[model samples]
Target: MTLALSVDGLSVWYGEERAVHSVALEVPVGKVLALIGETGSGKSSVALAAARLLPPRARMEGRVLVAGEEMSALSGAQLRRLRGEKVGFVTQDALAGLNPVMRVGRQIAEVFQFHRNLNRRESAARAVESIEQVRIPEPAAVARLYPHQLSGGMRQRIMIAIALALRPPVVIADEPTTALDVSTQADILRLVRELCAELGTGILWITHDMGVVAEVADLVAVMYAGRIVEHGHAASVFDRQQHPYTRALLRTLHDMRAGQPGDPLFQIEGQPPSLNTVITGCPFHPRCPMATSLCATEEPVSQRFGGLEGTESGLVACHHLGDQAGAMT
Candidate 1:
């Protein structure tokens, strides 16, 4: 399969603290791979590392390739060109990601002018086209307004338009719909899934929402405390979760569905380990209900597992994967 983005043993550290550890991920063309975990699980760090957008204080190891081009090998100008041409990024917050002073149309038009080297009029026209591509109505009129003038959903659509303006091979969306209302979130999700498929763009979608994964992801990677504990096809991962953390997360989803009003929200016990904390054995052992003494003293390597014949196989890292009582419904 042709991959739009590949990360091999990618690790990120901020001084003495490590945010990501030997994480590997792949985003194949025309598919969505949701990198999922709770806050501080290093999902965002992996995204930043993949895009070479990590902060100056962060040190990175391993390799990242976008559209078959190695990021570390590219020069400064080449790296900039690579970002503009090969990869697109949609940040979590639209208002923060966008320029408050610039008109939305001009912001998108600059992408065309800088990367595609289109003339002023050409770029302006293309900006409207990009906006319309995201399903925004009256694109030309909306394009002329500043980011602040638009509604939350429209601002998010603007961010998506900017990200996809160049039709880059790979797109990274970091929780782009977290702030939107239920109906607006559904619209945004559908818009992104349709646009990426039409353009044959591979998307690395970072989110904590399993519901979102069920809606849009073709594949899923479960991250916990800076490491990937599970990786597999979305259907396989959801239907037959093999790791304790994965089961816990899915249980929350089940509870949300089966619960009554004012019921206490289901949550995984214990907070995720801090980046500065030294972790021996499995990073999730402290919080994992299925963890044993072996889990506390020794790390579990990934193993292949499948639910039924002809199903897509997946990787899970858990010492007690065999114990399957009360499997997530």
Candidate 2:
């Protein structure tokens, strides 16, 4: 299977503080790879860096290839063209991503005009079609409306329409369902999955919602601090989680399903550490229930597990796999 997006040893830093560390992953065409972690876990940093949209204050290292084009090797003009033609980004905040002053139609049409060189009349027609593609009713009327004039869900649908207008080979979505109501969130999720699959577009979905991951991901990468702690097929990661953090996260998801309205919710005990904090061993050792002296003193390297008896393989960074397995028993 060919990859639509590939990252090898990708790292990002802001001045002296590192936000992402030696991350590696791949998004195969027509598949969805969900990157999930709590806030400050460097999930967004990895996504933004992969998209080559990092701010100037941030510095990046390692290689990122999108649609088989290495980002680092592309000239400014070439990079811009690559982004416009082959990459689509659906941001978390639809309002922030759109031009407030411009009608949603014109904003979506601009992509066709600039990248595909469609004239105003042609691009305008295509914009309406794209809006309809997202299942937004009354596309022409909605297209003429300003961002502020539309409801949150409508604005979000417009964002998706704009991103997919060019049928980019790769789509990077940053928490696309953050603030929508439950029903609308489900609608948006279904729409995005259907549209991407139809277009044969691979996705890098950056989100904290485990429910969202379970819903759409073909593969999953769980991040902690700045490193990926667990990664594999979504089924393996969720059904046979290897890392302590991954297990804890799924426990939270279980709590959501098993709890009542008046019941107290389960949550992880400690907040994530700041990027400025110094670390000597596993970044998660301070909060890991399975942590031991070894976990505190020696950083754990990633070790492959599973692939036995027809099981899918996975990578995990944990010193006490044997102990964790025993605990699970």
Clash statistics: count for each candidate: 0, 0
TM-score of each: 0.92, 0.92
Taking every candidate in turn, the Cα RMSD to the unseen true structure, in Å, is 3.1, 2.8
Question: lDDT of all predictions, in order shown?
Answer: 0.83, 0.84
Q: What does candidate 2's lDDT look like per residue over 1-329, in tens digits?
A: 68889998999999999999899888889888998877678988898888788888999998988778788666578777777467888777888899999999999999899999999999999999999999988999988989999988898888888878888889888875346654576677678888888889888887656776788788899999999998888988988888989888888987755655434333777977899998878988999998999999998988877762233677889998767667777
Quantify how close model 1 is to the true structure by its C-alpha RMSD in Å: 3.1
Off by over 4 Å in 1: 176-178, 254-266, 306-311, 322-329
Model 2 is weakest, by summed lDDT over 10 consecutive residues, at 257-266
Candidate 1 structure lDDT: 0.83
**Ten-residue region with minimum lDDT total, candidate 1:** 257-266
